[model samples]
Target: MSKIVARGAGVVSGMIGGAIAGAVFKQVWKLVAGTDEAPQATSDEYGWGEVLVAAAVQGAIFGVVKAALDRSTSRSVHRAIGG
Candidate 1:
């Protein structure tokens, strides 16, 4: 039962984390690039450097958000299960 609960929590947390990460990335990109839109890989207007930088920043943000949320959820579930 605890495993089942943890699995469910993980799924929910993952979804929430993705949303938070995406929003944070958008804001960060706006500040860093002075634009609301991050360049897609195939965008002709942006050079390779610009596209790579945006991808790196976005990946970092998403990783941090996911790790944080996963850690928090695991701890909460552990405590709730009296472990």
Candidate 2:
């Protein structure tokens, strides 16, 4: 039962985490690039360096956010399960 609860929580938390990460990345990109939109890899307007940098930053933000959310959810589930 605890395992099932954890799995369901993981799925829901992951979706929420992704949304949070994307919003965070957008704000960070705006600060770094002074623009509201990040560059697409196929966009000709942005150079390879710019596109790669954006991708790297976005990836880092998503990774961190996911890890944080996963840990938080795990801890909450553990406590609720009386562990």
Candidate 2, residue 33: how far the Cα is off, in Å: 0.7
Provide the global lDDT of candidate 2 against the true structure. Answer: 0.97
**Least lDDT summed over 10 consecutive residues: which range in candidate 2?**
74-83
Tens-place lDDT per residue, model 1, 1-83, is 99999999999999999999999999999998899999999989999999999999999999999999999999999999966
Q: Mind giving the per-residue lDDT tens digits that candidate 2 earns over 1-83?
A: 98999999999999999999999999999998899999999899999999999999999999999999999999999999966
Clashing pairs in 2: none
The lDDT of each candidate is 0.97, 0.97
Error of 1 at 64 (Å): 0.4
What would the TM-scores of all predictions be?
Answer: 0.96, 0.95
Question: What is the TM-score (0 to 1) of candidate 1?
Answer: 0.96
